[model samples]
Each structure stands twice: as structure tokens, then as C-alpha cells.
Target: MRTVPVAEAKAHFSELLKAVEAGEEIVITRRGRAVARLCSQRPLTAAEVLAPLWHEPLDIEAPEDRAPEPVAEWDD
Candidate 1:
């Protein structure tokens, strides 16, 4: 990870792209505050993006087992 000011980023755009291609993430900062990240663009299709959220409703039902019998005590 590396931080570069907006001016530097604009001046060395190709170098930044090369750095990103080499697996380095560059952060663009404005006034020493990080505002954006530069890295490889991985665009996913809408279906690919939302596929993980598609699932049947999880209908969890309570068990039907009978309750335990009450305890019996005998007094002599």
C-alpha cells in the first residue's frame, strides 16, 4: 500500500497503473487525507454480484416432541 497526493497521482498515472498491476494498492489523498484507492478493476456482472444472496427462505419449525412427564414423589 502506498499513499500519493492527487497531484502526484495525476502526474504519474502510468506508473501508478503499473504499480497496481504489480499488486500494489495506491491511495490518493487530498490534503493528506485518503479519499480514493487505485487498483485493478474487477467488474462483476449483476447476476454474479447478487448470486450469493439468492436462497430459499430458511423455515425453521419448532420440534413436535412431547413434554416430559411430571416427577412423582411417594411419602411413607
Candidate 2:
């Protein structure tokens, strides 16, 4: 982890971004107080968000004889 003043952070913004991409944590301080943090953006892996709802394959075709009418008819 690294801490830098606001001025230094502004001066070396590109370098700091590269460092963050390499898994480094950075803290931006203002008047001796920590105000902000910079960290790498972590992408969601396939397993994290793409878990299958069902494992077995099943039929998913629309019925040919399905009625097109609504259950309740409303008066216009």
C-alpha cells in the first residue's frame, strides 16, 4: 500500500493507475487525512455471475395450439 498527497497524486496519475492495475492499493490524503482510495477494477468471472439455473436440458418450444386470447377481456 502507498499513500500520496493530493498534489503528488495529480502529478503522477498515470503511473499510479498502472500501479493500481498491478494489484497495488493507493490512498490519497488531504491535509494529513486520508480522503480517497484507488484500487484495481476486478472483473466478474464466468462462475461468479453465470451459474446455470438448471443443469439438465429441457424442451423450451412454444406450443403450437396455445390460445392467443387474454384470460380476462377488458372493455375499451
Candidate 3:
């Protein structure tokens, strides 16, 4: 982890991003107070994105169990 002033961060944005990509965390400070953090974000797989809902019960009904919708008649 590292702390950098906002102005310094802006001056070396590309370098900071490269460091973050290499798994380093950076904290940006404004007037000596921490304002933001920069960290690498990896793409999530479909399975990973749906993992939280995997164990939850779904209330969806099968197509065969659904009521049939009425057909409308058209006049020529």
C-alpha cells in the first residue's frame, strides 16, 4: 500500500495504474487527508457472478405448469 498526494497522483496516473495492475494498492490524499484508493479490478466469470444466487431457491414455474394465455380473434 502507498499514499500519494492528489497532485502527485494526477501527475503520474499511468504509472500508478501500472503499479495497481501489478497488485499494489494506492491511496490518494487531498490536503493530507485520504480521499480515494486505487486497486486493480479483475473481470468476474458468469459462474462467479451467479455464485451468490446458486443456493437460493427460485420461485419460477415450469412452462408446462403455467396457465395458457387466451388467443385473440382478428376480424378482416
Q: Lowest-lDDT window of 10 residues in candidate 1?
A: 43-52
Global local distance difference test of model 1 = 0.84
**Each model's lDDT:** 0.84, 0.84, 0.86
2-73 per-residue lDDT for model 1 (tens digits): 999999999999999998876567899999999999976765467655656779645689999998999889
lDDT, model 1, position 73: 96
Cα lDDT tens digits, model 3, 1-75, are 799999999999999999988767799999999999998797556765566667876678666676888999999
> Ranking by lDDT, best first?
3, 1, 2
Model 3: pairs clashing at backbone N, Cα or C within 3 Å: none
Model 3 stretches with alpha carbons more than 4 Å out: 43-76
Candidate 2, clashing residue pairs? Answer: none
* lDDT of each residue in 1-76, candidate 2, tens digit only: 7999999999999999999887677999999999999987895455533445557656688868966876787899
Ranking by TM-score: 2, 3, 1
RMSD of 3: 7.8
Look at candidate 3 and tell me the lDDT of residue 76: 88
Best by lDDT: 3
TM-score of 1: 0.53
Stretches off by above 4 angstroms in model 2 are: 43-76
